[model samples]
Target: MSTLEIRDLHVSVDTETGPKEILRGVDLTVSSGQTHAIMGPNGSGKSTLAYSLAGHPKYTVTSGTVTLDGEDVLAMSVDERARAGLFLAMQYPVEVPGVSVSNFLRTAKTAVDGESPKLRTWVKDVKNSMQSLAIDDAFAERDLNTGFSGGEKKRHEILQLELLKPKFAVLDETDSGLDIDALRVVSDGVNRFTADGDKGVMLITHYTRILRYIKPDHVHVFIAGRVAEEGGPELADKLEEHGYVDYAGASA
Candidate 1:
């Protein structure tokens, strides 16, 4: 089984004022077949950790280490990180004005696999995955995220996750702006990806509604840029009832 390990990760971002530390020595480990949920108030650095793992230029790793199966993740380039089995579904998926979804998917698959998949099977795979995600066939011809709704954009992210089959997927606010039907479809896609085992998921979300469908194995309360608490599914139940007020006050 693959493993993603993070230890004492400190990250900084440059702002108008100056370089400001965001992630203050965050630590976590995710093993294959496990799902971890990160819940916190805004500005708690949940998304920062996700982007740092994916190697966004806006965030700098000032210290600490991140590794996938013992290979240095913080050292790899962004594309190399994807090739090494790391995927980040962003909070806001950017629109690629000129790229069709089909072309983008194929290009990304080729890059990650080091060669193009045979057109025959690749086409079939894409078709089936799209159908499973409830995505219309004609939507594939449109430019990526150009005119898509929030639900559609999130569905497309899961579509990529299902087809790409990365070892670890960091889903940041995937449930945001999704209606109940769309949420179920996306959750089903994730469940399908993890059903067989040997994959990891880091689901960063604000509400516990998605947890009803996804069922994280662990729940981490991220506050003030660190994991303030951790527990099993019960933690999420408490959060749903009490909210992040307790933790937010402490962080503030």
Candidate 2:
């Protein structure tokens, strides 16, 4: 069983004033088949944690270690991490103007699966996922997120999630900027992907709206670049009502 563990992980970024710390000796452990949500205000290093797990070079891992099934994830390259069964759904998914959805999926499938999915089977599987998400098949012919609506872009991210089937996923504010309908669609897709009992989710978000659809097994309140409180799903409801003022003060 593949597990993602972050042990006293500290991250920093280069700044004029020297290194600015983001994640401050954070510790988390997520085994397969669990969903953990990290919620906090802006600059809480939620996204920074996600990016660091995915091996983004900009955020320096100043100390500690991240392990995937006991393997050192910190040592893996960006592509290596992806191949090692990690995925990140960015808060602002980037648009690639020249890459069609089909091409992108095929390339990624080849990379992750270590072989090309048979064209006939791959098309059917993709279409099935799209249908479940209420996505138009015609959308696949368009460039990857080029000229896509906000909802469309988010759904496209879900499409990748479904197709890639990563062992561990870091969804960075996937609920941000989504309308009610789009939120439901994206949430539905996430629920489907995380349903298989072999994957885990580390969801970083500021809002509780998405939690209604995909209930997290655990919730952590991030404060001052570290998790200040850890609890169950009820923690999300508490944060919804009271907000993070208490967390901010305590962490400070």
Candidate 3:
């Protein structure tokens, strides 16, 4: 089984004011077939953690290490990290006006897997993934994320997740701005990806509604850029009931 491990990870982003620290000694581990949820208030560095793990250049690793399936992820380039089985679904997927969804997906798959899939087979796979995600086949011919709704963008992310089939996935705020129907569709795609025995997931979300669909195996509460609480499925329930007030105050 694959695993992603983070040990005392500190991240900084360069700003005009100088280097600004975002993630403060964050540690997390996710193993194959399991789902972990990270819950935090705004500005707690949740997105920073996701971007750093994905080897984004803007987020520098000031200290600590990230490993995927026992390989050093921090040392790998962003493309190499992706080839090594690391995937990050961003909160805001950038729009590429001239890039059609089908073409973008093909290029991404070729880049990550180091070879192009046969055209006929690849089209079939894309069709199946879109159908599974409840997305219309016509959407594949449209430009990537151009004028798409937030829910549609998030589902498109999951579409990549299914098609790419990475060993470890970090989903950052994927549930944001999704209505109940869209949430179910996105969650179904995630569930399909991890339902097997060799993929792991780290879902970063602010709301518990998505958890109802994915059913995380563990939950961690991020307070002031640190994990202040961790537990089983019940933790998500508690957060839904009382919100992050108590945990947010604990790390103050």
Candidate 4:
């Protein structure tokens, strides 16, 4: 019954010229059990909307408000946002040189829950989630994405989603760098996360391939930093056939 609401969100980032605006004025609402897919051409403010909502320091919110179940999301710190039931799977997961994957996930869970999970049960949960995502057990000891393949990094990202179980997840271009088989595997992970009928997902990507597997409840066309159109899953098929060409003449 919870809702994640975005009202006229405007964001900006620093550039050589000055503070350049990104998200012009995004307005959308996603409730529990709904999967909303955002599709657009490259450089469209798609990622900006995701990062801004996640409270990334690089993107500044010039105006507007984001709320989760009536709680002020913009007012919270980055970590606070996660604790408040918000999650973002970055397009490129950064390498953590010394942090083991197991340690990192557990630490993140601890931070979000304000307490550590029991080691024995947590280990079982991690193993099960990893197995489901087709990740190797040896990876538990490896540094986070230190030398992992693109597909592996993306799998690790969804692994966090399965483990963290946030109220709403905003995935930014997760389909990037994934081959066909790996794409299916990652899509399966996202499907598993949203199958509970109590979580929400905002999947941001350019292709409609992932949509075939994940099946968004709603599809949105993002252009010029704002949502140009919103419709059912049929909109994705149109994008696949016609591409974003019809939506051209708009700048990001």
Per-candidate TM equals: 0.98, 0.97, 0.97, 0.98
Q: Which pairs of residues collide in candidate 4?
A: none
Q: What are the lDDT scores of the predictions, listed in order?
A: 0.95, 0.91, 0.91, 0.93
Query: Which one is best on lDDT?
Result: 1
lDDT digits (tens) for residues 59-95 of candidate 3: 8899998888788988898899999998999999999
* Models, CA RMSD each: 0.9, 1.0, 1.2, 1.0
Candidate 1 Cα outliers beyond 4 Å, as residue runs: none
**Which candidate would rank higher by lDDT, 1 or 2?**
1
- Checking candidate 3 for backbone clashes, the offending pairs are none
TM-score of candidate 1 versus the correct structure, residues matched by position: 0.98
Higher-scoring candidate on TM-score, 2 or 3: 2
Instruction: Residues 114-219, candidate 4: write the lDDT tens digits.
Output: 9999999999999999999888999999998999899999999999999898999999999999999999999999999988899999999999988889999999
Each model's number of backbone clashes?
Answer: 0, 0, 0, 0
lDDT of 1 by residue, 39-132 (tens): 9989999999999999999999999999999999988999999999999999999999999999999999999999999999999999999999
